[model samples]
Target: MLILTWVFVVTAGLALAYAAASAIGAWRWSVAARNLVAELTAGRVAPAASRHHAAELAGLPAPVQRYFRAALTDGQPIVTAVSLTQSGLFNMSAVADQWKPFTATQAFATARPGFVWDANITLFPGVPVRVVDAFVAGEGLLRPTILGLYGLGTLQGTGEIARGELLRHFAESVWFPTALLPSQGVVWQAVDDTSANATMTDGPISVTMLFRFGVDDLITSVSVEGRATTVGTATVLMPWECRMSNYQTRDGMRVPLTGEALYITPQGEKPYFKGTIDTIVYEFAP
Candidate 1:
């Protein structure tokens, strides 16, 4: 009886220590996220008066110009930041064995190219897992915590991960139409009548994406070469694509409300993330 009691005491103490550590880690992460959002908000560039002018599309490819016209009005306010909610199925394995249903909320800042996504995955009847994926100020981080007590996994990096995340932010601009407008650090070149290439440079990171448009002048897909994808324990650079569909108007702008992300593997194309956007709210600098 005494031995059992002693074992119980030790186990309880260990669990307490783990809980305390997890709490501390979560607190630090929350504080860092808040500080990052504030810093980016303050550094946002002021929008130009001619941002929505038709003349601003002069040097852009014709298809790119048409996409702007289809997605935005003559004087839509440029979106500096956006908040959105999404529901989707997130795959847990590369073999497509397990898929978990999830709902997430994301905040994105275009001025500096950063985003914070928080998701809750339903894994069991009474328990849920929380995941956070974010890129801020040239840093990329992914953290998954179970029951707010134990961290399942964490991936944090700066160089390639940061660049890839920046590319992601640029591609996701499909949901924030005004973000694709001609900007100081952004340039568009024609690929063909159905496609264009966009190069976005933010500080030391420069990434380009090929944008494919449909007959209606809406973006159908965005593809990037040498994008990073995690395979096994190693991160591999590969061709990646995001296919958009279900066009709808949100807050006076046409945007894609549904999409999926696929990695073009040597074997074939494998799609991993699928999501439906429920709401999008734009925030502009005053």
Candidate 2:
């Protein structure tokens, strides 16, 4: 009976130590994330014209114009920054369907097109993986950690990773529709009645995406060819796509509440990230 009591005490002490470590690690990570977000939003200034108007849509592609008309209202304030919370499933396997549930909070700065996404994925009960995917100062960063302490891997570079992160920023612009407008550096070209090509450039990186629109004038999907993806230890360019749905009005603007990202491999479409937005708060230009 004494031995059993000792074992219980030891186990309880170990569990308490682990919980304390995780709490400290999470606090440190949160501090770092706030610093990164500050860097992303620094030097941003309000646009000369901070409100949307129908006149701004002229000369854009037909589909692009329709999308703006449906997504933004006249005199609507342009979004300068955004923060949102999300919950959903993240696929852990590259070739198989091993999905884990996750919760995330993201912040975006539209003036220079940057974002930081902080997420926690539950590997199993009581075990969580923390990840931060960000694009700031023309550099892309992907950092994943177990319990916010031990990093599993870190990916950052100037070429493919940077380009890929920028592409992600541009593709996800639908949530902040005004960022896709001409005044915001997006160049739209008509692809068809239902599709258009939108290109954006930031410093040394430039990307183009094909946006498909539904009859309601909302974005159906955004696709690009030659996005860099890691296979084993090598990096390769592959076709990638993001689909948006469940449009709802928020802060006088229409935005998608659910989204999914996938890679179009030679075999077929392999979806990896699927998320639903829980709440969104916007900081409009003054």
Q: CA lDDT of each candidate? A: 0.81, 0.91
- lDDT of model 1 at position 239: 96
lDDT of 1 at 262: 83
TM-score of each: 0.85, 0.96
Q: What are the per-residue Cα lDDT tens digits for candidate 2 across 121-205?
A: 9998988899999998889999999888989889997788999999999988899998988877788998999999999998878
Tell me each candidate's RMSD, in Å, in order. 3.6, 1.3
Tell how far residue 24 is off in model 1, in angstroms. 9.7
251, model 2: CA deviation in Å? 1.5
Q: Candidate 1 — which residues are off by over 4 angstroms?
A: 1-36, 48-50
Best candidate, lDDT-wise? 2
Clashing residue pairs in candidate 1 (N, C-alpha, C atoms within 3 angstroms)? none
